[model samples]
Target: MTQPSDYREHLMAAALFIAGRRWPVFPLRPGGKRPALHGEASCPRTGPCADGHRKWEERATTDPDRVRRAWSAGAFNIGLATGPAGLLVIDLDVPKDNTDAPDGAANFRALCERHGQPVPTTRTVRTAGGGTHLYFTAPASCRLHNTAGKLAPLVDTRAWGGYVVAAGSVIGGLPYETVGPALVHPLPGWLQFLLIPPHPVVRARAAAALRNAPAYARAALCNEEENVRNAPVGCRNATLLRAARALGRLVASGDLSRSAVETALRRAGQTAGLRDYECRSTITSALNWSIAHNSGRGAA
Candidate 1:
């Protein structure tokens, strides 16, 4: 039986999202371009930043007051843009999604689960060439960049294939009409009032929040490949080895222990810090390749 589109049902669905712990922002206008956030300022045309990235950064900085205002306007459907590589777009009208008719809905859900992101509901767009849009909520304290950065690594979607719809957009995907306003997911209320200045307490809080991020996020951050590639060689070798070993063991036995894997990563980091250095991304690709190809090694 066809069910009626109840506004209340959506409101209720949004309410259930609160259980996911994401902070609410502005009303999300589903299936349309979202407006720029209130306090955002424009980035300078020049000076050490990518044009696109600079623009958004400027907006975020310039419109401090407006941004604060928007933060205060509390509601669901609002979302912050984030990515380890930077902000991205989700162009749903791409030829691939149309031609392949891929099981994006399932893939999206699985990716979310694998990354430890709370499961979000998946729906098919009712447009001419149907596409899919997945939705879920995370802790309000979770920064958009961390969330996106973490999710980006886990997803297998093609770049132009599945872009992230930016804020101020009504069309989530061509076929998938985003029901905004009450359905919006915003930043957490507590986060809005945070000072975010150079303070011990704030720093401590930030560290704690980062530590509490979903397992997938922590794993990605500590992944041997990413850490080694980004860090100095002598420092990252052991971690790289540990990461490779973990993936090898997981693929070979299909039995990966989360605690064990983290312990190895901690060892690698400690080994490096003793020499005084941290932060690595150089070996990320190699480690990823090793982990992915391990299972295929004798399959042919």
Candidate 2:
């Protein structure tokens, strides 16, 4: 049996290995997802340490020295930050009742079939809970969202603003084991589209508006729309905000309904692969700014 000290050393080495790949990592409590730290009683602040280790998302770091120090303090599991690390992990959870139906994997396969592409083999981690974690590099313009059972029963995603317990981490004496190739693959474009579909209302209105526009105006609109669709990930939010502002102007000119313009810009933003929360916030903020400066014509 591996001694407790040996296990601690293994975790430290593993954490450094992941960090070497540019993935930000943090320490988790031994055998758990929680940050490896003393309880709130150890916190000196009267309220709480909002930026402490317990805040794994904020505390996750790629600094090798910090990782070394954290692991040296005690036995700790590894935690991988999803967003900042530019990763999207598909988590296939095993059913607790020991049923043989692998619904999650089945649905994932079905989704791949619909896209007419084979599932890419990537780094896969077998969870101590009998689940599997498939790692992929996030798409250029896309921000995948964390969802539970949305793709299929027992399937989950850890994306931006989330974290995953790293492979080689132990919980309750069971270590997460690597089950496949160690390389993370690029997410396929078709799958990216499905995962980040446009909002229905916005899609409908945008289509209708485009269909009714004059030919010359339609050409300009098409060009503008294409710019949003082709934006890169880092600029997607800003592109969407600009689109929203332009739409706000159209609304002020009585060329489009205020709600429709907002929805359409939001839909285009989402389809171009922006994070939903950030996309919506950008749309709202941009529209408000436009209205405030444009004589309150598109106020809503």
Give the number of the best model, judged by lDDT: 2
* TM-score, structure 2 vs. true: 0.62
State in Å the error of residue 31, model 2.
1.2
- Per residue, candidate 1 scores C-alpha lDDT tens digits across 1-300 of 112333324423433333233222223333333533332145444432445443333332212334344434432233333222122222233244345543444444554454445543232222223443333232344333222222222232212112233222223332224443334243223222221112366445545654655666446545653564455756465656555555544533334333333333434554654211111221234345556667555564
Worst 10 residues of 2 by lDDT: 45-54
Error of 1 at 232 (Å): 25
Q: Which ten residues in a row have the lowest lDDT in candidate 1?
A: 274-283
Alpha-carbon deviation at 281 in model 1, angstroms:
21
Q: What are the clash counts of all predictions, listed in order?
A: 53, 1
Q: Model 2: which residue pairs collide?
A: 31-171
